[model samples]
Target: MAEKGDFKHEHMADEANDNDTVDFSNNISARIKNPLAGIRQDVLLRDVEEFAAMYDLSDITPLLKKGALVAQNPADFENVEGLDDTERDVLRDEVVHKWRQPRALYTTVILCSVGAAVQGWDQTGSNGANLSFPVAFGIGDTDPTSPNYTRDLWLVGLINAAPYIASAFIGCWLSDPLNNYFGRRGTIFFSAIFCLLSVIGSACTQNWWELFICRLLLGIGMGSKASTVPIYAAENVPALIRGGLVMSWQMWTAFGIFLGTCANLAVYNTGAISWRLQLGSAFIPAVPLVIGIYFCPESPRWLMKKGRYSQAYKSLLRLRNHPIQAARDLYYVHAQLLIEHKIIGQTNYAQRILELFTIPRVRRATLASFTVMIAQQMCGINIIAFYSSSVFQQAGATVLHSLLASFGFGLVNFVFAFPAVWTIDTFGRRALLLFTFPNMAWTLLAAGLCFLIPKDSSAHLACVALFIYMFAAFYSPGEGPVPFTYSAEVFPLSHREVGMAWAVATCLFWASVLSITWPRMVAAMTPTGAFGFYCALNLIAFTMIFFWVPETKQRTLEELDYVFAVPTGKHMKYHMTKSAPFFFKRYIAMNKNATLEPLYRFDNVQSDAVRSASVTAYNQEHRKSETTKKLNL
Candidate 1:
């Protein structure tokens, strides 16, 4: 009997060994076949209750503790390496995918559309108001050489600069904190309220100062949108489709500018209805945006990162069609935070912005983003946008003619920006920046010379107009979207909002200075001199892009850190994977698509800790099984 029992025990031991061998073989084989596959393998949803329970006792315990995934154990803890492989995998999965789907991309589009429309309305509203302001304010007819003309132009310049200046400082303050505090939808709601107040104030303004104040108030909302919209999009989308989604906002912004131009033309032609209707019409676009954003899902990341994992999971399920996918994504996000040693509550507002500049890698990214934003502003694009009508009028076009020309410029901007939206992922940042700068500089220089030439000659006027068209077309791809996209990309996931705010604030600062100064500069230098100055500034920017700007076209946010934050040796040759016929190897490098996947979904199962609270869910499911058993009985 003893011998028989020993034999049976040995047989059981052998079976256990065989099972272990099978599992190990499968795991090893999977790793061998695809090395990078495991990076995102955790994105697949599994049984959350089982995973959480298993992970609580395993290697991932340390990480769960670090990510605040598991509450701080009162007991002393072991290191992450101490956990066994399966437990570690569970913990890793917990960190990567969220339990919820992202807010619908369509929802994001609608929310951000308000911000973009605000940008357009402000740009065009001010443009239109500036066009008619001299007459509206009773300053007198605009003659470029007249002192009255210059003063009146400066007042118009103030109106254009007001929103930008206010947005620069105020936008930063409102965007990151409000996003954290109120959540994305709430922040957008407040922005809508601010915008509403701004519009109402503007409509009722009796004087220039009041109008300026109203514009300033409106700008706070606009600035908030500018900073938050892209951040919201980046946080909500998956890594696969990020570029297209973010740039779509830029596309709509350009579209808004186009619409604004059209509005300006209609108002200008209508006589007395001009400035009032033009400024008032600014409120139209944002109304839909506000309504859309109100109904959109919250950012799951913001919630999860804040230790509200259940809420994050629910948000994710709403964003994605597949519940498992959403859970998987949440796990990945947590995993990344664990690897980086980032804890959400540990970081406050100031710390977030400070962290962006304090880290070496982050500092490099800051510099790159800062330089790029500054370059975008100094490239003379806003100069044209803010003062295009004034510029055309000075070059000898009639007021009505200049308004038409401005509309034409907006049309060009709207048309050409579409290619940028499509190709930003395919062609890349380096290629676009490389080609755009020289084209704009040369064009601006030529246009400057045209202004310097005798104004009486139609040839000079034709040349100036031709260059303006070229400038707008070339600008469509780079300046219009790059500043916005780069700001979203440069910072780490945690620091995105504040870091973006800082960068955008800087842009607004420079924009304010430029918008305010350009009119006076034009008055002092004449159109020829102002254009020449811009041409020279752009030439310097061209040099910077060639030497400094890294190609970030399709890189994941993490991958982008390597290019921007990591330092390369001066003479080291940068090799990029070029997927091609091997012909364009020198000019083309491997650029990844900057697409982000959706981050919100519904029905994603969270941790067992949270799942236990969901008795209604299980009860509902068990009801059918119970009914079947009772019938059988």
Candidate 2:
């Protein structure tokens, strides 16, 4: 019986092998006559070849046994360069044309924008609460005879900072792994529950400790919001416009800041109920995130990594408007993951945190993350957001005048963020950061100098307001957006969430330190000196971005991994040039010699540099022909 069973299995295997050979032969012959047919045919087969070549999978039996046809011996990885400029432009145009159909990309931008709106609400809730809490609680100088006025101030700062301390670090840590296990919707749903609880807890607190606990829990919700929402936004948008759309999230954040600041003034007019009302207003937007995230799609990239191919295909279709071949898009996402999994295996929390420094590209990325986060916090963005009114009053503006000016500051923040959002894709990440740093540094220096002017002088106060506007205008576009965008994009898929969590944690960590320190700094050194210190920090940030920051704009997440994952000099030489001169020079010469050589096509392995260049050029030539055909000129 055993012998007969073995004979039967062998016979079946032979039959299957025969069938596969016939099909593959038919596909090759069919594609030989049809270039467009070959364009889509055997894409996965190409990927397998590319993967085998790039990763040296000839020795790996399972990959071979799993139906991948072996090709030439794998090439040295260093020998692989990106597609030359001509090819890149062609492929880029092809991708753009594909992305322009029914506007699934636009829908993705909108859904992710909604999530950002929630983030705005979360950050701004405390902004208003910061101001009115003291007034509403009736903690005052009359009590200085009983308790030091300074102590009350310290307590206010503590209470104000408590949520960021409690929430920021922990939420960032949890966002990615949870998203992996539960999907984007599930993580967002859980986060919204935290938001709801915090909101209810905020409205019902009976004493300072109760309020503190409530704020602490609210911080947890806010932390979740801070970490997960931006990830969703980045993952949803197409890479071409990713910077612009993702930066829009920060724009909404600024809008929220502005709204919250304005709300403080509106609610302050409510007499005894001011702070309670201010704290509770956050619930309005918080309700929508809980309800809305349910309707949002899971990140298609995340779905592909888990081999949930059908779901990934559908999600990609939804995001790209069901382009000519939606499933074809997964090839790129999957190929990138295969390379990433080579380094990180899969998402393990402890392993990821460690790998952030261990992997060379990841280490550069982690540094980028840390620098951007540090720059943002040290730039005094929070001071503007949380305590602008206070700064204005200390600089000798009337309370009414200062609060009103803060409202205008919020408006300017939103207005200026539009240009940042618009230009992030066009100007690129490095350009925006490079351009904004000088303006921000100079503005801070000028604002600090405003403090040197006589307190009673109206002209000095006018200069102070100009400084405020300058600070918001410069910051809203660049420093504010770069940190969030860079942290989310730089890490590979396997470790992105964890990396982001740690990055956000760093920001929160420093933010807590700064938030706690700012009041004391102001108490000790006055507003001018404090602003001067921030000016100096901006100078440091300027140098960091100039020297170390790579432009992530217009690059796919996979391309980013390719760029920074290698040693610095090597990565830059290939990635920095828009048109890789080496590839173009090599290919121009190689094409003359190898015109008769079979063109290589592998799906899993990236196209060989020359062949990839040809494919890119082929697409571009086709586009030019198509455009000419369209115009009938």
Candidate 3:
């Protein structure tokens, strides 16, 4: 009764429906497919109307309708009706002049920078203090022959590692509850209090144990602040330049490292109390962070999550340049959140933690975040960050010269980080990691080998410092910026705080391990062996990163759910089959025309239907070819 053509059309439509069902079942494939795509205009309008009514935004219902349309398909915003020229120009400026943001946004980023400075200064205060604190506390053991020598080494390491141990085990985990109840600004304020008190307490401590206890308390602040600041920056920033902005965390951390070294040098002349001054001076950064956090707006995403949509709108209004831009982002983020909630579902705290591993999409993000965070520790930057003065002393420099050399390393680190702000968004996260890791590997190896130079030779310290500075130079632009920025953006809103806690925990745990072990490791293996071990680790980190971590640059925090939804095995196989060969041919083999297809498809609403039709047609053609081959055979 049905004609052949009609039968074929029905069959194709049936196949498309089957495909859609399969995609929906996995949730992964459906997530990768844009939620905005193929959404009917009438349905979107109706949803917008309902959303406005539910949220008590009836006064802006007309604006909300237009905003929803623009949010659904941002690429077509220019053609979106009802947008005045001012609204249109603001959207255009978002793309063309990405950095031209509201002063409040820049202020928020700067405040976050100050928070990072507290973290860095906190870290390196112990670095300068490492020189004198052990002596003051009666734990100094420069003599290898002393009975207490081994015990002192462990004690000093334990003291240095105390903060990180606390951060990894206790402080990072607190971020979830702190952020949940206090909000970003509130959590940051709370952390700054701990940082302020701990630094002053460390300065006033009469003994090593007292100092250790103070540093342990410092970790509470460090972990929570570190976890929140990058997420705050990421949520506030536009995705087009998100990487550049969020990475300010590391850049300013580097600046704080530089300042710490300056404080070390500045107080070198202050007798008896110089180390105390060195440790307490870190409190200065915390002071600004505590006072200035109140000046910044709370993260709008966090506000939205609390069911305070009106407050979120008000917050976004301050962060974005114009009301329409604010409205668009608010509605867009809300739409994405609706879809995200449906897919992720609701869960208790424990269940959310479990879902991080149980959910396919979230599992990929967890693995990636773990990779980057651990890789940061594996790169061995913190070894230099925590003990560069001591390292310089071991390299045959005088105490003053060692402090100066440490200052040089700090200066190089801070200066080199400037490039990443420009490169991170444009050149991309994964590519920077790939490019810098090998360079870091060799430079670190070279620095380690430089330690083998005879102490009497003029070139010994020079070569050591040169290679160490070079290692820092390579590290500052790549690994330094990528970890926090990458980890901050990967998780969905539901898991963001916990996911970041997990990530920061991994980082600090390894940092604790490194700090605790490096003293003994260097004592047993010597500097060459110690540095060589981390150099090998750098390569290992590189391999893990190439296979596991996805490029997150330029994607919205909401959009990244789709990116991570891609199954891990398939992503790795594509890299092996396609990206590897293309890299080999294009860069290594010097081929000009080698092409590699992208792994993820970024399609707008119309392309979703087009892609479905194309897939169906292709399947039909492939079946015909197969049948002809079978008949011919």
lDDT of each: 0.63, 0.63, 0.84
What residue runs in model 2 are displaced by over 4 Å at the alpha carbon? 1-104, 118-125, 138-147, 569-633
lDDT of 2 at 494: 72
Scored by TM-score, the top model is 3
- Candidate that scores best on lDDT: 3
List clashing residue pairs in candidate 3.
Answer: none
Model 1 residue runs over 4 Å out of place are 1-103, 138-154, 342-345, 558-565, 568-633
- Writing each residue's lDDT as its tens digit, candidate 1 over 1-633 gives 111011111222232233322121112211111111122212212222333443332333333333222221101112322345454333333323322234475566545755686676667667767766657666644677776787776776677788888889796578988887787778777777777668767866777778889989987987787777777777776544566567777788788788888888776767765777777777877777667676687887677556566567668777754444454455545443432332222467878777776765566667667777888887898877777887788788888878888888888988998787656766766567767888898888888888876878987667888899899899888767776776777676666778878887888889888988887798688777888898888889876665555556544454343344335322012322221223243335433433322211111122222333344335655998899999999
- Cα TM-score per model: 0.74, 0.76, 0.91
Using TM-score as the measure, what is the rank order of every candidate, best first? 3, 2, 1
- Error of model 3, residue 5, in angstroms: 48
lDDT of 2 by residue, 132-244 (tens): 56655655342435666677667767776776787675676678667778876787778777767776667666666677777777667666666766777788776666787
